[model samples]
Each structure stands twice: as structure tokens, then as C-alpha cells.
Target: MKFYNFMTSQDSSVQLVDQAVLLFTLGEEKEAESLLVEYLSRHENDLSAWRALSEIRLSTKDFSAAEHACRKALSINPDDLTSNVSLARILVSQGDKEGAEEASSKARVLGWKDELAQDEHNG
Candidate 1:
């Protein structure tokens, strides 16, 4: 895994996320989660951190927490395709088929929009 240069004069929030990613890669999920929680406490509007937290919770089978984190990320940016997909997975794990389908559809539409935007930019 690629590690960020912590010695560089980067933003503290970025450094914190880099550390959390390192911990997560080392299989120190609880430590990573704690770091992410700390980061979120200071940066509640950070969508990427919310998404990472959601993924960690999902890996731990904490479906409700995963959904909550996913929702938080979605609230920050409702058009985020990855968060919508994560929400779908979390809902599916919790046996909420309808919610999962809705999330899935949202993700699909977002993906299509992204592709169209890319095509427009390239073509």
C-alpha cells in the first residue's frame, strides 16, 4: 500500500486520514476506526472519512453503524455514487431489500451521470 509522506506540510486532516488508512491496512481496524472517529469529530463534513468509516463498520458486520455512516456521507454529498453503493450493501446486509434497491438505483443513476459527464468532457 502507498503511504503518504507525513513529514510534508500537508493539511492535518489529510495526515489524520493517511494515518487511519495505514492502521486499517495493517489490520488494526479498531485503531483505524478510532482515528477516523477522532477525525470526524473535528471534520464532520468530510465525506471521504464518513465513507471510510462506513466501510470499516461494514467489514465488522455492524450494519446499522455502516448505514449511519453511509447516510452521513450521503447527506454531505447526495450525488456520491460510492456512498450510495455502500448504503445499498449496508441495507442488504440488514435485510432491507427495498432500501437496498433504492440505494442501488441511485448509485446506478449517479454512475451513468458520471460516465456521461466524462464522455462529454472527452468527446
Candidate 2:
């Protein structure tokens, strides 16, 4: 596979994932989501891709799908602070305050103290 100087060398180095993020940034949400879904099909264990998928779904108010993606990321790495926080937010949106708090508390304990909103919004 041809390498791009911009894309980091990693197991999840699917050009489609970067393209999806670009599409999303360009306000082409549908195309971005399509690309992400395609990328996920082959790179199911990619934490970054899962996180992006969850964020995109969340933006579209697809709570269930977002939660599923978040859970997928968590399954890959339960200690993923971002996924924990995302799961917390998804749970809160689904009116599961208890679950949300639990997830949030776990994220807190995991030392993910940074504000997630800025990065999440960009995604």
C-alpha cells in the first residue's frame, strides 16, 4: 500500500478513515459515515475509527448506533478513556443516568481528566 506522509503508520492505517474524517470536516456527513462503516468492516479493532464512528452517529442523533460503536471501542480496550467518556455521554442521552455516571466515574478513575468536548466536536 502506498504511504501518505500525513497518515501515521499504524495497524489502523486505512486511507478511508482519514478520508472519512476529511469528508466529515467538509460537512459531508453521509459520505463520511459511509466511508467509516466501510473502514470498520475490515478494521473492527481500530479504536480511533470506532471512536469516530460513534461521534459521527452521535452527531446524527443515532444514539443506539453511537452506543454500539462506543461499546465496541470499550470492548477492544476497556481502559480507553475516550470510549468510556463517550459511553457515559451516550448513556446519559438514552436516559440511563446511573449507567452514565458509572461510565463517567470509570473515565475519571482512568485519568482522562481533559475536556472531551473540543475534540469530540471536531470529530
Candidate 3:
């Protein structure tokens, strides 16, 4: 993946997320998590980074941490479909069926809106 494409900000610190993703892909979960934690410390409001961290935690079976990270992402952008979906997944993993359902519903609504927006843009 192109690091530049994923970056929403010009700050050099964002590159850490790209590196962390690469490390995660290489099976270095601990290192990747460490980097993500470090990056988040400086850029707490980065939605993508929080989502990425949530994914890493989810993959590691750290459901609580994943939920926390996903919630952080949602706090930054409540309309983010991806974060809502992630939250649903985390909740499901933790056996919170009602919460998962709520999150899933939110994601579906956001996804519908996104599709509508895309169609509008294209049409």
C-alpha cells in the first residue's frame, strides 16, 4: 500500500501507521501494536490510526482493547461506517449481542448514506 495515499495529514508522524501496518502484515504484532500506541499518543484524533489499532487488537483476540480503540475512532467520526462495523465486530466478539446489533444498524445506515452520496457524486 502507498503510505502517502493513506495519510490524511501532512504530519510526518502519520508515517508510523504505515510502518506499523507493514509490521503487522509481516506478523510482528507486538511491534506493530507498540508503534500504533506510540503514534496514537501524539495523534489521538486520527480516525484511521485508531481503526487500524482496533483491527490489530481484534486480530490478537484482545476484544476489550479492540472495542476501546474502535470506540475512540467512532468518537472522532460517528458517521464512519468502517468504525461502526468494527465496533459491531468487537461487541460481537465480547458477546454483547444487543450492542453489536446497534452498531451494525448504525453501520448500515452510514453505508447507505455513503452509497447515496457516491451515486449523487457520480450521477
Off by over 4 Å in 3: 1-14
Q: Scored by Cα lDDT, where does model 1 land? A: 0.90
Candidate whose TM-score is highest = 3
**Candidate 2 clashes between residue pairs 3 or more apart in a chain or in different chains:** none
lDDT of 3 by residue, 1-123 (tens): 655555456455557778888999999999999988987898899888898899999999999999999999989999989999999999999999999999999999999999999999999
Q: How many steric clashes between backbone atoms does each model show?
A: 0, 0, 0
lDDT of predicted model 3: 0.90
> Tens digit of lDDT per residue, candidate 1, span 1-123?
998766743376677777887888899999999999987987899888899899999998988888999999999999999999999999999999999999999999999999999999999
Model 1 weakest 10-residue run by lDDT? 4-13
Over all chains combined, what TM-score does candidate 3 have?
Answer: 0.89
For model 2, how does the per-residue alpha-carbon lDDT over 1-123 read when each residue is reduced to its tens digit? Answer: 996666464634556667788888899988988888887787788888898899888888899999999999999999898899899999989999999999999999776434565567778
Total backbone clashes of model 2?
Answer: 0
lDDT for 42 in candidate 1 is 79
Per-residue lDDT value at 93 in model 3: 94
Candidate 3, run of 10 with poorest lDDT: 4-13
Q: Roughly what TM-score does model 2 have, to 2 decimal places?
A: 0.78
What is the TM-score ranking, best to worst? 3, 1, 2
